[model samples]
Target: MSAFSLSQALAWIKAAAQSIDANAAHLSELDAAIGDGDHGANMARGMAAVTKKIDSAPPADLAALFKSVGMTLLSSVGGASGPLYGGFFLELGKQSAGKTELDAAGLAAVLGAGLGDIRRRGKAEPGDKTMVDALIPAIDALAAASDLAQGTAKAAETARAAATATAPMLARKGRASYLGERSIGHQDPGANSVALLFAALAQACA
Candidate 1:
């Protein structure tokens, strides 16, 4: 088994924050095409809070780390994303309670649980022009891998492609859904952000 440490998980959160900050403008631009333009600002702010909270508190275990990330994002971010992402992490924490190390399958289980929370809360399906478009395929790729390194790397790649693929899809959920036909030809910001998250996880494992 390839053991993943708590420090690696912590690194993933920090990298995610940086990725959000770096892509904030891009995210908002994508949102503006089909929904409200505040997605980037809200995500950046929430991720900053997540970074600050983790840096100062330094969670002792995987569950605590996931909880800190979940609670911080829930309170700090605005709009639908806060609850979705926050609930994702909260569920991840719950599933991973008392765990400190992860093999490929172990990591997949926690991440799968987190994605389940997002789907349950948002009710988005594949090809819905939502984060589910990116997340579902990415997790599937991960689940098919033989090791943590390969899984994460493949997941990240799948997520990016899935996010890009959302551009041609008609929005069927969230604020973007209200745009109807006009939502076509625009990428889903939530999907892109989810891609960024997988990228961060891949980076952490690297």
Candidate 2:
């Protein structure tokens, strides 16, 4: 796809919800190793709320859609994931305001804005073993792509790899930081969820 529309955005949200639901248990298990074990359930609940919001009162525009998703996640999810993920989507909405469709450059701007928001909100760096590790690489990959589909696909792949690479890193932020050296061998739950988000975006663009 050359451009991303409202329908495609909705599809991406739906796909994210489904992917979260399917991996909820695994996510929780991953979190149990280093952080709170509620990441999966919290994310699943938030995505369900987003789905309900979409089904009950469909957004009239891309901005509305992203805002609705962001707000719903903010209110429904638990733990730090609620605020961090919620802020990401809210910033995406803000960057995409007044736009009906996004081309490659527009999508890159939206993702970059979201990543910046996450960085500001969380104050975490790439090697902090947080979601930033996945998201930053994904943003870089998306920015380098030539088209929407290719960009999203590359982003998803890069995000997944980045998330996986976080396994050996020590946590410097969030609940995992409490573990210090103990957090080194475990994968970061937040990074996993970030990877899932990009994976869903890739599928939607495909």
Candidate 3:
């Protein structure tokens, strides 16, 4: 019964924004090895905007809250991540419509839907060494958990591990894909951000 509420989601997003902000430099460094070097800055800006809006007046419903974050990120963040990540949240909102709290199964269903949308929009998959690699496992872990808290924590851990796991994977999507085997040893920026999202949600659930 410890399902995450809109307020909790909002709080988690804000905390995630700050965490992203703190890690912006490191993220940028990571991206510099395989990306445009702006992933960190772009995500930081988008999350900061999301945090500001939520701080002003958080949404009460899941749809409204995620819509707000998605719209804000779409408007603020630049590059491929803006629309991709923003759309991910928007899709999750659509899946969670009318629900204030989601049990493990409910959370899993919504997350699966969200990942499907992201894959459709980004044209990536698990072995692509993109965020999907981390997100897919995290969602699976959440789905297998018995409760929201355990699910969130499992997702967070899975995301973190998957992000690190991506370092050895061959790139199959995004700009990194262009590097082929050369992309090895560098973590995908999107996976790192997804990890942050899961970590934030886990903290909020706590």
Candidate 4:
């Protein structure tokens, strides 16, 4: 699709919820290796709340939809993920305010704003072995895309790859940082969740 509308946005949210639910165990497994083991369950809970809130009330506008999702995540999720993901979506809503649909460039702008908010909230850099590793590269890929579908697909690929790359990096942030060199062999749970988010977006676009 050349443009993303409310329907597509809702689809993206649903897809994200489903993906998180499906991979909840795997996420927790990943987290158990390096950080706290609640990442999977927490993310699944937050996404489910977002889905329920959106389905029950049904946002009147695109911005409202994203804002509702953000609020739901903030209220439902736990740990650092709650605020980080919530802030990201809130920034997305802010960037998309007054717009009913987003073209390629609009999508890029929204994603970029979300990434910036995430970085700011987490005080994370690309090599920090945090979600930023996946998100920054995904945003870069999206920025070069010509349309929503292409952008989402490219973002998914880059995000997954970035998440994989995190396996070899020593943690420098969050709970994983406490592991020191021991963190190098494990994949970051937050990065994996980010990859799933982009993958869901790509599936929605498809």
Candidate 5:
């Protein structure tokens, strides 16, 4: 558990798929309040693709495996979430190149890179009601945690907290922003998904 492996990463993807599937209706409900009403379905389809790819032929290393997931999700899923989350995982694969197991510092760096990719791709800043708010704080918490398990749990908690905090904030990015002030009082779909991502990681790592 000190370092993540391809199998472990695949396990995370599977867990994330299950989480997304389980929450699909809720995610759709949340998106209907602010978006096109496809966040849940899109994420579920994307993760299902990733799980299928891994089941067919698991990659040899972490980088290849995660990259495969990224590409699969990007192709199989549509909407803003596909490219944003796809880029996040692609950046993670790049950051984790040549490593099977990552230490605490390595985890921080990979998550940082992933967050940067999300920000750049989405052109989002904190408080924009985008995934960046959750991802950035989750990474910060993971960086500060003492161990991998603790770090992942902290990351999940941070994501959940950030998503909740978004309820009162006006959306400034993505489809949610089109709602103007009406966006307030709704949890961002992306932020909720970010929470699911970290929670899946925690489950896999545990």
Candidate 6:
């Protein structure tokens, strides 16, 4: 088995932060159409804080690493994203307890755990115009892949497509839901961010 190293995992984290930073404006622009117009900024700030936390504390294992990211986002990010995204990572920490590296199956478990918590906390399902839209499909793709190489790449692709697909979906959760029919044409910023992070994961592993 080709084990996914701790270094690769850390690289994924850093890359995710960088990706979010780069796409902050675009994310916020997407949010402006259907949300409070601050998702990009909020996520950028939260990811930055998570980076600092990682740099300063440098967690010892997968569990601690994910925990630091989750807690940092919870404390630093504003709005509903703080809890939803933070809870996702926290669940990752819980599932990853006592480990450093992951095989294909282990990676799937971690991702599934994260998605499970997001669904639980956000009360969102697929096509909800939320991150759940992208995450659910991505995790499913990852779980079905033959290995990490194929899995991460396929997950990223699936998430990207799912995010794009959200544009036509009616909002059923979160602030976007408040808009009802008006939310139908706009893409979900949260789903885009989920897509970006998944792309970062694929890149880091490649």
lDDT of 4 by residue, 101-203 (tens): 8887788789899989988888998799999999988988988888889888999999999999999999999999999999998999999999999999999
Candidate 5 ranges beyond 4 A from true positions: none
Across residues 86-171, which tens digit of lDDT does each residue of candidate 3 receive? 89889888988888887778878987888888889999867888889999999999989988888889899999999999999888
Tell me the TM-score of each prediction against the true structure: 0.98, 0.98, 0.95, 0.98, 0.97, 0.97
lDDT winner between candidates 1 and 6: 1
The reply for model 2, stretches above 4 Å from the true place, is none
Residue ranges of candidate 6 with Cα displaced over 4 Å: none
Q: Cα RMSDs of all predictions?
A: 1.0, 0.7, 1.2, 0.7, 1.0, 1.1
In candidate 2 the C-alpha lDDT for residue 91 amounts to 90
Every candidate's lDDT = 0.92, 0.93, 0.87, 0.93, 0.87, 0.90
**Consecutive 10-residue window with the lowest summed lDDT within model 2:** 103-112
Q: After superposition, how far is residue 65 of candidate 5 from its true place, in Å?
A: 0.7
lDDT of 1: 0.92
Candidate 6 residue 139 C-alpha distance from true site, Å = 0.6
Q: Which portions of model 4 miss their true places by more than 4 Å? A: none
Lowest summed lDDT over 10 consecutive residues: which window, candidate 5?
A: 1-10
Residue 136 C-alpha lDDT in model 6? 85
Off by over 4 Å in 1: none
